[model samples]
Target: MVGSGQLRLLAGTLCAYERDGLAYELQQALVYVDDLLVVGNSMKGINCLKSLLDKEFNIKDLGELRYFLGMEVARAAQGINICQRKYALNLIKDTIFLGAKPYSNPMDSNAKLYEKCGTVFKGPSKYSRIVGRLIHLTHTRPDIVYSVSHLSQFLANPTNLHYQVALRIVKYLKNEPGKGLFYPSQNNTKVKGFSDFDFDWGSDLDTRRSITGLCFSLVTPSFHGRVRDKKQSQGPQQKQNIAL
Candidate 1:
């Protein structure tokens, strides 16, 4: 496929292809150094392709995806549920924050955090590490994306206020560490979207630049933020179709 142009490498470890036997018009495979995820619309075709790849490489089909990266996958007649249950538990254990009481909310709604308002965190490295893990947690926990994103900004010089807020998120995670993103396999797969942006909503104060909050949700939420000019902050275009 690579030589015939049926498949093209999108980037390192990611490839896009089209197979005559595939159920969909396009297919994709991702490589994580040693492992590969053969994804497409047709299970039969996926297995067949896996067989062919196995002939040339030491490839193995581990059956339906139950775990990938840190996300756990569970499939049933009703739907497919994905979560970071194990990851979340391990995170709490690693951070030594398992003693915290669960919080209903991830962050304080009334709080408007900025760099200048709190006591400086002397050793901000741990804060940065905690924020990094929280960022990954947002994969299955859309509920905490905003809170984590807000705390991420203080990575360079986090404050005690920021660390406390980040801990609040950890507490929130404790509320339901096994909670996940569930997509009904029986429902219509049409793409639905929701988005919002605050145009020059407020000032960063530290940078003397206006701040903007831009976020969008299809089924899983993903977002970006900055103080860029209007033209630089437009919505992203869908580059490929997604199937749950």
Candidate 2:
């Protein structure tokens, strides 16, 4: 018992826990490595939890969260905007496509990729590094999620074609590096989800599997969303997982 009530670690989460106070006040803390983010319905409750934590571990309060783990956070009367504009710019600079012409689309619909079709790329590490960074950028740039997912399948045996496609995505990022999600101030607690499946059976040339795309959002009267793509062997199981 930290103060008046018991503080319990929440199940199914890495390092998240909650503390309760008298009068039904509650606060929660999310710990990621050395960083801690605290949230609660009331400032008094949050402070109480922090005090308890400070007594146990030496912790520094970093004021309001403006940035964390490369994601930029900005708040206003309208809402909060999260983006990785600086990270995206740095990604572009690290690649050869900095001055390449921007494309309207992230991927080419006409191009189909196969495992053993193109000549193997000599520098697989270069392709892996860029694709890895692109995966991290997906935290704020959901627009490239599908394209990046498509290219990731080739990381182990990347080809010249795969490397070229990866560069194309970097070129596409040049169009609007600052593009990101916005959470409006006038939003409700309703959660919304959307999903799509590629009907083409041979979408995956190597495995002949189909790709399912899912998106989840908070209802801000507008959808602020994140996207995920999965390749599934069975339809019913994947659909059930999507339902949850």
Candidate 3:
């Protein structure tokens, strides 16, 4: 035989093995600390790999993948649906806006957020903590991303108005704690992108700088940005090379 007892490189966040040239068509074992998730296209191959792991180590077979890293997994004929309802509920419970009424929109269209106009928050640490948790919640809830990005601007010196808007975002979260993006398990998922920018929306009283909001989304990393600039002319012509 090759060896009597040969166990090598059995600890890692991700593990993959392939004897043939095909790598992506084979099995995959993803591990987060102690939680191990074995997955593959074919159920027969998956079970065989899992059995080897269980025999070598003492890993308990949880069978199917349901929940991992705050996201719930539900398998079906159409496709797999993922959500973070439990995580979102727990997040609401941990915050001060649990009992608050829900709202339809994450942000107020009439509300214009000026940086240095409102009264300063006495407890900025609390505001920062809430914003941090909200950022984590955005992992599954992209709907609140605009609101969270808006609130994050005032982290250095958050005002009462900013804090209120942050609470409003939490209230938005209360609308549907189970609401999350559905990622259909299929080949050929199309990618789409759109960008928008504002032209000197509001001018700061002290600095004379204007506010600009820019947003763009890629396949994975979707982000929005707020820029303070004095140049107001030809804002749209700046990025003419960007395709879409």
Candidate 4:
């Protein structure tokens, strides 16, 4: 029984123990940030563990677990459904992207963003900071992962064109603030991955490297994926796959 910093490690240890059949009384336990949830077959067993935790740390009994880390958990006879709709909505509101129109895709396929020779940056740092925030938002918004990654290459010395592209992404977010990841009750449970590369994508620059892209998806459990790109040709190739 643990809380706070030790809670996650203890949960892992308990899970391993349960998997090894070392414990029968402890049924299920979940840890998120500073919160801990322990469910056992008998009330006596749960109370015993709770008492131990209370002695060790200042513990709060939350009873049944409904939400953790912004994820809503609902338990039923069929299965458990987890969603972050509220979190997603809040994020959109925080970013002020709620009222914007939603686009069917993350980025435009026809747009070509690149730095040209003799192009002077009016304010590189400010543009870079905005792009950086957009990149972080891609963690939950996979749709924009490729676009954000593609735009990140010019972070060090972003040009005016780069800033325009980043602004477009922000505008897109404004259009579809409510959109987010959805985990259905039924999905395929297969792990599939895709990889691609673009040759001489950064031909405009002195660094002559192609961009590489990779994506991994679990057809079942949860249908979520991430897309990452390099600085050169390989990066745009990855973005293309993500857009598809």
Candidate 5:
């Protein structure tokens, strides 16, 4: 199990118990913020740890683990399915993109984005605030990660062009409001990661730092991989920036 804030200590205590053999058959567990993730093979092991929590803490048993940390969990014979439908919906509503028309893609393939050298923002703070919220939404919405990361580049001094690009992202979100990453049950368990760079993709901007995009997949319980790259090299550089 994983948790945040006050639950951090609870998670730590659980780990210690597993380490000491007080909780049997436990391999590993992780706690971050207020989320808890527990992994074990035996029912006895999980039950033992749960018993410890019941006896030592006031934690409630949510039972069967349907949801955790914004990811929706569902158990089936094939395996588990995890998605972030709720998180995406809330994000759309928060950004007032709930009723907007949806776009087929998060960004236009032909759109070229650049820093508006002399343009000033009419509401710099508002743009920053919206982009900030979208950034958080990216945790479960990888489809928009590149778009949000691009928009975030202009938070320090967002221009009219930046705001327009940001709105375009919101509009994109509106079109595919239900889109999210899907973790299939039947797949290899290997973990893998891949990384690539777009050299000087942002050279046109003063920062000159190329954007990096990455994706990860698990082929087995012990194996997974990731892929990363610069957004511009794959297509046109959207008028967006990330603050270092």
Candidate 6:
């Protein structure tokens, strides 16, 4: 049995095996702490693996997955929809932004954030807390990713202007609490990636760094992404690697 390194944080362990006679048939078992998910193309294979597992450990079958972590999962004939509506509403309610005006955009493109742009915010923790929550929301809400990431840079010393912009992001979430990703049931496994580098060089006032954004998708819907400001390399070798 092979183990997965990616999900080690949740004490997750993965075991995958191919059926001896059937080369096309592959089965996988993902164990996250005590919860286990058995997946395979054939029911017979899945059941056989589960039976073996049940012999060693007491297991309860949860049937079909409806929810896991903060993501709400709904399956249909066409696709699987995952969202965090409840989580979003709770965040909005806790922040007292439920009645705030909804925003058409997460962040204003014209706005530029600087470290010492404005007076330091009184409740710095509040700003950090809100921005942290927004970062979690980005798991299902990629639309707010850039905004959240931008705000995260100021967590150490957020200003009143930064705090106001952070609240604006909460208002934006109020616009569509149920916004999420949909993975079609019938789709190709081909991976596609798109990336963009900021044309406006050295946009970050404090670090004088440029930003790079990348998104990777399966077929059409993006599943993984990152938006981060690039820092200057310490050495010439590292700088060459960054350029490459």
- Most lDDT-accurate candidate: 2
- Tens-digit per-residue lDDT, 120-163, candidate 2: 99999999999999999988877789889888988899999999
- lDDT of all predictions: 0.69, 0.73, 0.64, 0.56, 0.57, 0.71
Residue 20 miss distance in model 3 (angstroms)? 3.3
Off by over 4 Å in 6: 1-11, 21-34, 37-42, 222-244
Better of 3 and 5 by TM-score: 3
Tens digits of per-residue lDDT, candidate 4, 64-135, equal 555555545555554445444455455445544565655556567777667563366788777776776676
Q: What is the lDDT of residue 212 in candidate 3?
A: 56
Q: Is candidate 2 or candidate 5 better by lDDT?
A: 2
TM-score leader: 2
Q: What TM-scores do the predictions have?
A: 0.78, 0.79, 0.68, 0.57, 0.67, 0.77
> Where does candidate 2 stray beyond 4 Å?
1-5, 11-26, 218-244
Writing each residue's lDDT as its tens digit, candidate 6 over 170-192 gives 88878778788877788888888
lDDT (10s digit) by residue, model 1, range 12-96: 6434455466435445676665556678766665555565566667554555666677777766676667788877888888875
Count of backbone collisions within predicted model 4: 11
119-229 per-residue lDDT for model 3 (tens digits)? 999999999998988898787777887779878878999999988888778777777776665544454544655554456644444455665555444433322221111
Candidate that beats the other on TM-score, 1 or 6, i.e. the better one: 1
RMSD of 4: 12.2
Two-way lDDT contest, 3 vs 5, winner: 3
Number of residue pairs clashing in candidate 3, backbone atoms closer than 3 angstroms, sequence gap of 3 or more or interchain: 0
